[model samples]
Target: MSTVFDIEQKQDSAERLLAVADKEPRYILFADEFNKVARKTVESAIHNIELDFSWSKFKNQKQYNVNGIKQVHLLRMQMKESWILDAADEVWLLIDRYKPKRTIGTSGKLKSSGFKHAIYPDPDNPKRPSEILITGKDMILDFGQAFYFKYFSDDAHTAIGYGNKNLYQNRSWVYLRFRLKVRKGDKTYYSNSKGVIEMLVKNDYPIGKTLDYKLV
Candidate 1:
C-alpha cells in the first residue's frame, strides 16, 4: 500500500489537492498542510477508500486559504476508476500534443576572467586547458495566465512562468493559445487556455482533465 506522502510527493499535499480541484467538473477545492506522517495517513486512506477523482501538485501559497480550516474537500468521489484514469490519460495526451516552444533561460557565468584573476594554477600557457574557461547564460520566458474550463472564464487566467530559479523566484510568464476542441453532447464544453498550458508543462496534470495547483 502506498502512503499519502508517496502518492502526494511534496512538503505540503494541500496544494496538490487544490490543483486536483481546478480540473474537476464540480469545481470544489481541497487544501491542507501535511507533514510526512500526516500525508502518508491521508494517502493510505485515499487508496484504501478507493475514492474517485484526479489530483495535482500545488506550487504557490497565495492561492490557498488555509488560515482556520485544516482539511478541504475539492471534488466529490463519484466517478468510476476507469473513468478517472481515462480522463487523466486524456489530459496527459493533450499536453503531449501541444508541447511548448523552448526559449532561452536566464542564468549565466562570465565568459572570460582576466589572467590575473584566473582560478587555475597554470595561467602562463595560452594553449593550456586553464587558458579558457567555459561559461553559460540563461534567459527567462514568461508564460502568463492560463485559464481552465471549469473555473476560469474570459477575464481571469492563472499566471505561470519558467526559468532556472528557486521556489521563491525565477518563473516567467508567457501567452498560450488552445488548439484542441472539447464538446459534450454536441455542445462545446471545454477549451484549453494559457493556464492549462502552464499547468500541463509545470504541474504535470493528466491529459484532457484539469486539477488544482499551488506553489509552495
Candidate 2:
C-alpha cells in the first residue's frame, strides 16, 4: 500500500504525488533513496531554469527608504514538497547569468593568517584549510547603497577595483530579485522580500511553466 507520501516518477512532472491504497505490510525505506532523488531534481532545475530578466526594469530613486525587514508573498512560487527544506544545502542567488566581458579569472585567495576573525581558520587547527577560497561568483560589491557585481581580479586578496574605494563595499541583500524560499510549520512557501522587485524564473527549455511573483 502506498500512502499519500509515496511519490511516483513521471516523464515530465514532479508534482504528481501518488497515494495508492492496498492491504500490505508497511516497512520503512532507506533515507538515501529519497535524498538522491530530491537532490537530482533540484540540480536539474538549477541548471535548466530560464531566468527571465526582460520583465525586470531598473528605476532610479534618490531618497529611497530601504527597509531590510519586510516579507513579501510570491504570487506564483510554490513548494510542493516538505523534505526539500532540510535537504537543500545553500540557496544561491545567480547574480550574473553570463560572464562579464572582461575578467581576470577567479578572485584572490584569502589567507587565514591575514585575518583575525573566527570565520577564517586559525594556525592552531591542523585540520582546517589554510586559505578560504573566494571565487568570482561568490563576490558582490555595494555601490551607492545598491549591490553591484564585482568582476573577477587576478590581484592577490582583492577584487578588480571599481570606482572609488569609499563608494564600493562588499555587502549584499538578504534576499534580492525573488527566489525566496520560506518555511512556516510543515509547509514551505516561496516569495520575495518586501520592497524588492520581482525576477521570475521561467522553466522554458527543461521544464514547463513559470514561477512568477508579485508583492503582497
lDDT of each: 0.26, 0.28
- TM-scores for all candidates: the values are 0.15, 0.23
Count clashing residue pairs per candidate: 42, 0
For model 1, state the Cα shift of residue 2 in Å: 24
lDDT of 1 by residue, 1-216 (tens): 332223443343666666665586456323333344554454333233222222332122222222211222131122222232322212111111122334445544333311122223334423222111111111111111122111122222223222322112212223222222222222222222212222321222232122332321
C-alpha RMSD of candidate 2: 17.3
Q: Kindly list the per-residue Cα lDDT of model 2 for residues 107-189, writing each as its tens digit.
A: 65442311121222445432322222212222221211211222222211111123232122322111133233333334333
- How does residue 126 of candidate 1 score in lDDT? 30
Candidate 1 off by > 4 Å: 1-73, 81-100, 106-158, 162-216
